[model samples]
Target: MMFLVITVISTFVLSNESSRIPFLNGDNFSDWKDKILLTLGCMYLDLALYVDEPPEPTVKSSIAEKSSYDKWKRSNRLSLMLIKSHISQSIRGSIPPSDKIKNYMRTIEEQFVSSNKALASTLMNKLSGMKHNNSKSVREHIIEMRDIAARLKSLGIEIF
Candidate 1:
């Protein structure tokens, strides 16, 4: 039917938008998390991130309660799928599984904290050792340096 075709097309377009987020390999969790949050926010799919899951609806439940539960369930399911999809298989294997988006995200944050320190030190060393070389244009060299600094900033190092 026309409705089913329209639904499938819309879903495809929306999913393509999420492909802008990079895979969460071990070294890129902070950047990946930032992109994930931004993408979810832009799509209005971040309800599960900010809210607890709603209680299940019963026959006696009010319409408002049923609606809230439905909305939360959809948000939770989709957000989990999006987050899991962007993580690399190697890193994904280490994560403790959880159906609850909030709990899963908390675990992910914890998993990355130690690695972030390692990443920060690696970036710091690179920044310290970088010198102006004639090999690349000044613009390119500076742009590369700035990109490193931005990545460092995302990891909580303020290099400005």
Candidate 2:
């Protein structure tokens, strides 16, 4: 019972908000991806994004090779944890738990990083038709329109 309590406490303490970079969430993946890369790059662990997905035990692997694999696996796990920490709770289930950081990131990119033409067109129409209402300042309205253009541009549909 004592060990169980300790384990639970330690897990909570170690996995809490203090360890995360910031909230990236579901709506701002482009900026969030860049932020995540920058954060991990500063730590010199950004290469974990390209590392092999899972570490496998070699039947006749040399000590050096095995050690190298283990090191990469640890970094990969760190990358995965960081990604998981920043993922918005609303879209958390999109990325399943996996050992390979490359595949995990790939899956996330495919699922949430798309630049659909339909979405871009909708944004363009909305931008052109946007009006400033009494509740919002002109600054707020312009920022919202600029954000839509930015999103459209990010999707390769520039309308500047």
lDDT of each: 0.89, 0.71
Off by over 4 Å in 1: 1-13, 132-141
Give the C-alpha lDDT of model 1: 0.89
Tens-digit lDDT track for model 1 on 1-160? 9999967865875587697999998998877988899888776678999998889999999999999999888889989999999998988899999998999999999988998999899999999999987999999999999999998988888897
Ten residues in a row with the worst lDDT in model 2? Answer: 13-22
**Candidate 2 structure lDDT:** 0.71
Collision pairs in model 2:
53-100
Q: How many residue pairs clash in each candidate?
A: 0, 1
C-alpha TM-score for every candidate: 0.83, 0.68
Score candidate 2 by TM-score against the native.
0.68
lDDT over C-alpha atoms for residue 14 of model 2: 48
